[model samples]
Target: MQKEAIYHRPKNNFAYAYDERTLHLRLKTKKDDTLSVTLIYGDPYDWKDNVWQYHKQKMLLTGSDDLFDYWTTSVEPPYRRMRYGFYLEDESESLVYTEKGFFTEQPLDTNDYFSFPFLNEIDVFKAPDWVKDTVWYQIFPERFANGDSSIDPKGVLPWGEYPPARDNFFGGDFQGVIDHLDHLTELGINGIYFTPIFKAKSNHKYDTIDYLEIDPQFGDKETFKQLIKACHERGIKVMLDAVFNHSGYYFEPFQDLLKNGEDSKYKDWFHVRSFPIETKPLPSYDTFAFEASMPKLNTENPEVKEYLLQVGKYWVEEFDIDGWRLDVANEIDHQFWRDFRRTVKQIKPELYILGEIWHDSMPWLQGDQFDAVMNYPMTSALLDHFAHETISVETMADRLTSLLHSYPDNVNEVAFNLLGSHDTPRMLTLANDRKDLVKLMYMLQFSFPGTPCIYYGDEIGMKGGADPGCRECMIWDKTEQDTELFDFLEELISLRKSHSAFGNSGSFHFVSAKDGVIQYKKETTTETLLFLINSSEVIQSVEDLSLSNETTSLFGNKIKPNTALTLEPFGYEIISL
Candidate 1:
């Protein structure tokens, strides 16, 4: 036994409430170190005749990453409280692991164990229930389509006539999105995450000019309401981008600050280092990424807080949008987000809140702030393994396992998972234009947990490098789009919707990942799904698939049960049991 490798904590990913009644506990040990683990747990107060009442349950080996194996189990305490410790066994020895230290014998008293004090229902992390079933499609409105050229922005170029630039617009609007409702429906995605459709100076719309008004290039308020109505009619939810972290240079408040300096009534609205603001190497005031045009708002200010909070409430209250994808959420204060959550959820209890945070975001996901972050860590793992081939299949599996165990199941379920957003290079481009690699990437994405998001043109095999390039206009001509890839993506989305095991609530575990091939399984209470993918050029054989009697081929070529199967180069399979 690798005693030094044993790890656990009283809370967080190691232990947490799956809900009010159930507690999920996990322990980590060095890879292949512990032969078995038994969880000895009971309410700390459940004592009779000077002996603590307790129960012991065997923990299952849930997953392994490159460095560790994760053991997990779910238990229900009659009293909604728990004190626990672990018994580890290996060929060489047996030992007790407790809160204080490792021991040769189990501790007699419960005080030596870790305590979960109590499971508070109010503290449970509850994301929107609908998010678990949603497949999101991200649209950069300015580059998606040109439905009404009459509302085109000044100097707008012909659609798809040239490569995208930082400040260029091709007249994409809500009307265009309304026109393409059928496309989204046929593609089988149930949610639309539109980036910054509010009034802004730039084409991407992240630099907000008005939080309450829709950008003229996208359409007016009424047209947006119509678009939302159209989407809801088609069984699709709408999520708008909220750029509350900063304001554009031309925003009325910011402009006034630039003009009035110290005398501006809105002087407290933003952070200012000096009387005369400068915007050269660095601004005299704080900005988003040192960009002078984008000034960070002082969300702590009372007036600014009220204004932004109302902005958070306006869209859902007026247009009935289903969610808000907060821009640069990590840069803002926690209290403001908590108030924002209260304001929005009061309007619609189930409305989703996604944050554009690129790193660890546990602080914002405790049910009091944003429901989920953008999940860029998982995206990086996928890209590193599938697109760049910089990491081995085993390494990828380990990375994913670590990520999945980093948060509670509820958080993982609603996490906004995406691979080529407007911020990154296209999946196809990253895969070096290899459709096979792209298919493999999407296969893993759809099969893995979380709500998957497709960049606007990716399903049709649109390819480009990073930003400006990746933000190309959506291809509308059927003859020009890659129908084969689109159809395949549609099939994948359909599979996700129809199968319980593919849903975010299901369990995901790696079956195998070695010699240029990977296999994983997703298990729900009602079904089990196995995905076998070979990313190498040579045929790969996986033996002893361990199919049950109810196993059947869900997709890919049919194979015999409990027998070895050969996968062609870049081939994959989805088996249901």
Candidate 2:
């Protein structure tokens, strides 16, 4: 055995309390190096005479990536606390692995094994249970609809008249959202993630001037309350964006600091490098990516922490909002988020807290801070393989497998998975306007683990590039929209909701990935679902896929038992057995 390649650590992704009674454990070994792994575990105090009593259970080889094979199993420690170790073996030899070190045989003393001291109910990472069942729709309020054009900003353009720009507005508001709530409901979206509805100068609303007040352009707080009521009545949850990382130039504190130079009471609220703030050569103070209009907030300040915490609490306590999506969450200090989570969750214990982080976010997801982060890594992988064709199917599968193993299973369930958001190019545009490819991408996203999300207008094939380009006005005219793509996505959402194996309730595994074809499975205790996608231009076939007499196709054509499955270019199949 390759002892150096074997790895495990307690109290993180590798080992965690899956629930109050169950503990999930994982072990990693060099790719194909270990033929089998057995978990030896026992309650630390369950000993008699001079030896420790324990039970051994075999761990399943869940999946393997380029460099490692991941083994996983669950144990229900009777006493809710245990010491554990792994016995790994290859053809040549076997070894016992534990906290102390590798040994020729299983350690006699429990102290030599890894310890999960106890499984406290509070420490179990419990995100809102509702999140796993939700399919989110991300709406940029400024572009969704203009129900009441009377609230239009000064230079608001005619809706859909011109391509979106940083400075242009099209009079989208909460009333517009209220007007279009039916569209979301009809599309089966149960959660709406609105990007920054608070008062701000920019059309995107990331640069917040007022954290507590709704932007007049999006209507007043009363109208927003009505909108919330409308959404809740229709069984939809609302999640608003909170940009606590920075404030706009016109933000009262920032403006005051700019005016008073050195003697502003809010001086500690921001990171001002020098006395005279200058935005000419470079920002004299810290800002969001050198943009002079946005000054990064010093969240470490006690005053700033209290203010932001109240902002978090006010929405849930007052409006009964269901969730908060933290903007640029990775930039803030960890303690502030811990306090933020405690504050909002105390008001509504189940209120979802999502973070806008584009990379690995395990630190913030440890039951205390964020329930989930924007799954941009999965987004990038999907875009790379299905849309851009920059990576092969095998490479994409490897990347996804690694990502799934990066966090605890519970965290992955509520992960905010998205393909294109306000931050990236539309899925159709990224797929070079091939709606079939976009359909393939959607199939994988909806079938994969995590709560999937759809960017506004993506279901109808709205095409745009990044940033300002991605923020186009939603198409309201039925004649101009791609109704077929809409129907396809609607079906996907329906399947995700109606079928347990098709959603987060099932366990996911990559079955095959080769020659531009990818195959995977979502299996529950009673049912198994097989998904196949052909990313290549030419037709592809998979031989010898066994099917039962009772098998049925959820998508693609029905097939016979033990038949070879064939898919057209950019086609897919979802088989239920």
Candidate 3:
């Protein structure tokens, strides 16, 4: 066979794309390798509208051209922050940098951009404040309940085995989820954040074995359709977790590499060095360098970038999922995030994309990618005050004050406020099933600045911890059994629905905090609501809580703050005007 020059690391497909700093330019030239590769950067900030023409320079290879090493000509200085591509000298063919190999740049007219500073505000990643008070519920499918027992594993999974593996499958699924929609709606949850439903080997589905299909165990595509319709009917929105960080060990692309080694067509899809077995921990192999079961992807690969982008758009076009909750967001490269966010906005301008960040997310909240994230820090603060009581009234005030002042004003609107999720101990369980204390926690959750979210069963009181424990199913049996806690959650939820000024785009100010009594006010142009919670063990009273004129008394606000309105230990009050 005639010697062939190709970009396909799979060694079959000749297609090539440039990405990150390394340009994969291959050509079976009648000319020699002495030919120089020219790169130019004219558009300072423009990737779409402005212009760029290649300026020539000999492609140098004194050292390895790894993913992060970029190249350009002397005529055009490379812009550290920009949108540009590469061109091969012999072919005049240009390739754009992507998660996979490059694709030909389309006509400039094809690219479109809307007015700058999108959404209700300029912060691209920040969601509106209403997100926090609205209350979100995260559900892990398998282990929740086997709605269709027939689909359950033949007792072959870890949930049935001793020393269950975190990655084992137990068959909790969509139909089981369908059966619980009523429970979710009645509990007053406004958002449903589901773990990955896409086809994958592990029960958690973080490793996407197949991005295109739903896990058969989770039910077919239409079943989710019904679930979506039902959720929307009840005023609930659904968001699914997206694990773009990596895939399972047995994923098809990796399998291809195993079968063909360097000759595989998908060889470029992952990051592998020149040597086969020796490069096992290739740049893409050790994401956390913690495990070998999951292999990270070379998101800088142009084809890989396009492939994942297609997967994201496919779900939105096919199932109409309200948004995406990115799993292990920080693990991915910054270059990948920039492209990913660009593609997402091009597809749907308003789609909600929340990152799964634990510590703090203000950095990503800047104009570009995610809308919000799991409020792990906030959850910790709430639990500290109510669970161990290690937090004092003053300590609690300081924390709340920091949250209000630390983040940009707009971030409060879009944050995913959580007390508990499948990742953490259930809130009710954290409070040790103390209904009074639980009520106190939620009072702050709802009236505070950000969007609020309830764990699946926390509304009616669910309990568990990391992995199998945090993944417990909602208990319907309790519906008939415990009316006190159930009634309390129901009332709190109803209160959230009735108040708009307290929702998104509202403003929050700490009104007072003294003697284990904390109070705040949420206000808009037309409406205002006041909140008070006594996390103390003793009945506590406040001195003077200022109120707006002509305020009507409701649920917890019927009593006077100092004497008549003394809140007992773990008691909470929601006062609106």
**Best candidate, TM-score:** 2
lDDT (C-alpha) at residue 540 in model 2: 94
Across 189-304, the per-residue lDDT of candidate 2 in tens digits comes to: 99999999988999998999999999999999999999999999999999999999999989999999989989998999999998798987899999888999989999999999
- Write down the RMSD of candidate 2 (Cα, Å): 1.0
lDDT of 3 by residue, 97-172 (tens): 2223344562232122111111122322334333555567778777655677666654445343343356556677
The local distance difference test score of each candidate is 0.89, 0.92, 0.62
Clashing residue pairs for model 2: none
Q: Residues 1-577, candidate 1, lDDT per residue (tens digit)?
A: 8778899998877888889899999999999989999999998988899988889999999888878999999999999999999999999899989998898998988889988999999988888888999999999999888899889999999999999999888899989999989999999989999999878889998888888888898888888889988899989999988888899998999999999999999999999998787888789998999899999999999999999989888888888999999999999999999999999999999999999999888888878999999999889988998889899888888888889888877788888889989999999999998999889888888877789999999999898888889999999899999999999999988888888888775799988889988988899888888888998899998888786554457774566777888889999888775
The window of 10 residues in a row where model 3 has the poorest summed lDDT is 8-17
Ranking by TM-score: 2, 1, 3
Cα lDDT for residue 316, model 1?
A: 87
Evaluated at residue 547, the lDDT of candidate 2 is 71
Candidate 1 vs candidate 2: the lDDT winner is 2
Model 3 clash tally, residue pairs: 38
Give the best candidate by lDDT: 2
Query: Which segments of candidate 2 are over 4 A away from where they belong?
Result: none
Query: If candidate 3 were superposed on the true structure by all CA atoms, what would the RMSD be?
Result: 17.9
